[model samples]
Target: PEGSSLQACDEAARKLTEMILKEDGVASISTYVGESSPRFVLVIDPVQPRNNYAQLVVVAKDLKSRKNLEKKIKVLVEEQLPNVQSYSRSIPLGPPTPYPVMIRVSAPTDALAKEYAGKLKQVMLENKNVTMVRYDWMEKAPAVRVELDDDKLRQMGLTRKTVASALYAEISGYSISQYYEGDQAIDIVFRLEPKDHQSISDLGTMSIPTAKGAVQLNQVAYLSYENEDGMIWRRNLLPTITVNAGIADGVTGNDVTNQIMEASKEMRNKLPAGVTIEIGGPSEKSEDSLRSLLGPVPAMLVIMLILLMTMLKDVRKVIIVVCTAPLGIVGVILGLFLFNTPLGIMAEIGALALIGTIIRNSTVLVDQIDQHLAQGMPRLKAVTESVIVRFRPIMLTALTTVLGLIPMFPSDFWRGLAIAISCGLTVATLITLIVMPVIYCLIFNVGNEEK
Candidate 1:
């Protein structure tokens, strides 16, 4: 993943680093450019580590910032990058987990840090599941300040550089060479005592030596608190104020997100016309995926009905098979409820799989009973006899299928499928035993004498 690049990769890396550091929640940022493409690495803080699983890496330049740069990057990478099957704005290269909201706040000075910490703590305590909130950039209170007025420095025949060097000498101290004692070596440096530079008022009164004489800092320059000046966090290319929240064990990411959305909505409305609020996280992806999986169900049903008509040919036989399908589905629903599992996309797909298998079994049983009656056996006798003969194979197939699926129950990928099929088959087998016979007798008078 490393090689020399024709383009100035170092320049790109430096610029990207500068851009990311300006944003909040980012603890540290690094970049690497190889023969294939550039890679970005970011360390971010969320409300909880469990809620933020993936390390988001993007190859395209658009993802480098909050601009819609994905499309442009896709085109460029495709044309320039060799053997590229695809390129993306961001790819999750780590383990998957629920998504987290990004919250940002800036307090450059130590006094502001205390104020900001207090407000953040109050907000976090109001929400039960918020376990952690970390600051991206922090500035401690200034222990000393050295100030030089340009006019006064010019009149005194001394430059600001002279004043700065004198202050640095007093603070950093002069380092002496290492001295050996036995097998150990130690170095010495001289500076003011800890108490001499501990307070703002103390720093203001400290004396600075110059060629003319020693001068107190308060006589020449004003001293006060100051912090690093820069953007701390950003969103959509603008400086942002934000924080992330994690859900409790029993609650869903969506549930926690909804609460945050509700809390922020009133505040968001009060903001000026240029400002806006957006809620994003893993819940959005979950909702979208589920919708995609369920959206095709109705269309699939119509196709299935058409196929059933063509295959079964008889309306009565088709109706019986269709009727039995619901019993299987009802069983699946009840099973999910009993197990306390959410009916996710995988579960819905499992139900679809069960439908096909159940229809096949029903057709086999119903067709056999119809053949027996058409051959002139008494209707009740035919029903009972058909069930007796077919019962072993029917039960055996259902049991074998259920047993085969049992191993998959523990896996996330196939557990839903296993549960749905096992429950559907069990219910359909029972309904076929009890309901099919009653339906046959009501529809066809095989046991009754001619009128």
Candidate 2:
């Protein structure tokens, strides 16, 4: 807590202010807390009034470098303000380099906002994962002040209203004329060149032609900078500043998140007592969805088995019929692989459908064979007879199912499901027609001969 980067940030601000004051021509330098960085306002005495501009604010890579550069002020702060705290050198739980890190510093007043921003900017520059950081929330743009002199305007014989009208007319043009050429229509308007209004000085120097003579705008009015008004828009209702870092090409989101957590932990230990850090993104959503889907798999398998038993009745018959379920599954998996379709909810639903249809086909054939055996036919004859009799219906049903699914294969959403089902039904039907009857006959013979 004593050596927190925040403390370093505070020290950096004091140092930066001193550095600004030390520079020649600087009339005044002030630092204020900002939502993102410390806001520095520098007033410079103009050597030439015409070329005078606001002070330049230079941001460092991190707080340490800023503090290092402003060493003179550090000594001054220690001498003058003994109670002022300097941030720790290390972070307790700081993330590794190239991981995104976000920090929130709340100020009770605007003065505090400006003060903290200066410190935050310094700390961010020192941290490695902090590649790009910004704080538009606290950084106010200088206001453009156009001071109109009544005496100068009276001398020019131009009223304030006319001056205001001319300024508006030159900056924002009004549409004047419209003309048509055959089917095309075009509009034309009058306005000054774009560069004429690019800066405050350009606006000050603009000449307006009136009845008396051309009057230079600067002669009537002076321009100065002012802070922009209104609070900045924020995402998720937090005066949040984000520091984005680019992960290396091979790094995964999880890896980057882990690295950031590690670094943040280190940073946290060094943080002043009250500071806290939180990390979140798309990775959280993925983890939740994966856990929800994973928990139901066993229940789904048991349900499918129950359904197989209910439809087939006999356990042996159910086994023979359910064996085709895997053949269908193999077909679906192969279809997914061949088409390069990643298995998703729709594909899984397609697999479930394939299971039902393939089992039905196998069940129908085996049931018929059992019926023939129950009617007193020999086991071998019953199987041969069942296959010969069921072949046409099985082939017909499979062909119809394949034809129905053919139209769905071209659609991206349905194609995966369609291809899986179509291939599964085709392969499973073939396996069921050949292997299922053989299994049925063997089971019946084994049981009957033993009895």
Best by TM-score: 1
| Clash pairs detected, candidate 1 | 24-233, 99-282, 103-242, 103-243, 104-242
What global local distance difference test value does model 2 have? 0.60
Q: Let me know the TM-score candidate 1 reaches against the reference structure.
A: 0.47
User: Pairing residues by index, what is the TM-score of model 2?
Assistant: 0.38
Worst 10 residues of 1 by lDDT: 45-54
Full-model lDDT, candidate 1: 0.59
TM-score for each of the candidates: 0.47, 0.38
